[model samples]
Target: MRPFLIALWLLIMPQVVQATTDVYPFESASEQERFRELISELRCPKCQNQNIADSDAPIAKDMRDEVYRMMQDGATDQQVTDALVSRFGEFVLYKPDFNQRTALLWATPLLAVLGGLLVVVGLVIRARQQGGAEPPLSEEERRRAEQLLRDRDGGV
Candidate 1:
């Protein structure tokens, strides 16, 4: 079973890896480098966690084509990124611009961590306060407990 699975994986891996290499012929090395950088920096909407350079989704392919078209038409990196952002919203960017609209998205994790710390601190203070003193027993309850202990010790 292990051998069969390994063989199956070997057969399938090439096609998966080959899918991302849709090369567009660039006029210069710098243009090709820019293209690579742009694709790697742009997020694939369909794949969500993957950049277009690493994603094999149909939308990623379309985005790569659009980028190539824009680059061929002499668009700057910022211009191409801005164009895609306008079309797909800021979600298409791997590093989204720090803006008013995205402030919550950027701040949520830190806020959650701080809130968690506050909760932990509150719990620690409560535990410390409670531990500082033993709970008081009522007078009748204390007499009953003493009587029980006396009986248990055979009145010794």
Candidate 2:
């Protein structure tokens, strides 16, 4: 039974491995490199924060095939990117263009840092304006504080 299970596992393992790996026959090493670069630069539409090359989503597979087809047809990198953008929108780009829609996304970090700095400056200014001179305690308050200290120090 153990030997039979091992044989079954061996037969299924090849199919599983083949399913995860994609093979495209590029004309040259440069073409292969370009394909790799494009895939890595493209974000998977269905997988959050994963590049298409590393994604196992069906959309990513389709996108890879489309990229390969376009490259085989002599499409330039820009043309390929534009085509995908037209089909999938700018969200598919790892580095989206700086425009009205994405301006806030690009500026958020700077805005947060500036807001933190403003808060720190405002706190400093308020602290400075308030000054550190505490009012003298009244006679009754002084007697209460002395009692507390004496109790804490065992009447010493």
Candidate 3:
């Protein structure tokens, strides 16, 4: 019974410690709050579309540590982001910086919307043009159609 109790305590002790280890370390409450906000704004390089705060990847952990270190060193949020971008490129930022290289990323959506509108407008104009065109029937064809209608209606 003594051996069994000791093994159970050992297993439970590690679990308890693991729970505490999951918490983020910050020197002050404000630092922790700012760290949380900054992490949410930063992208995880290892996991695209996931913010650093929400990602469980090792790279996310490293980035979080780097942010915390920068904050401790008195860096502003934007400064911290700029540092990460310098190290990891714009892809690491949740919001890519607007510059010559990334201008296409910001412009592509608006261009696509404009292109789609142009296509729709072209289709509508084509449809109206087709509807307005006359069939150019010969006199004989017109007579034949009239005769058929008369026969169907019993001498109309």
Which predicted model would earn the best TM-score?
2
Model 1 lDDT vs. the true structure? 0.92
Least accurate 10 contiguous residues by lDDT in model 3? 15-24
> Who is ahead in lDDT, 2 or 3?
2
Clashing pairs in 2: none
lDDT of 3 by residue, 42-98 (tens): 889889699988887778888988998888889999999999999988888767878
Selected candidate, larger TM-score, 1 vs 2: 2
**C-alpha TM-scores of all predictions:** 0.72, 0.84, 0.70
The better-scoring model by lDDT among 1 and 2 is: 2
Score candidate 1 by TM-score against the native: 0.72
Reference-based lDDT, each prediction: 0.92, 0.95, 0.87
Q: Which tens-of-lDDT digit does each residue in 87-118 have in candidate 2?
A: 99999999988999999999999999999999
TM-score pick, better of 1 and 3: 1
Q: Could you arrange the candidates by TM-score from highest to lowest?
A: 2, 1, 3
What lDDT tens digits, residue by residue, belong to model 1 across residues 41-62? Answer: 9999888589998888889899
Clashes of each: 0, 0, 0
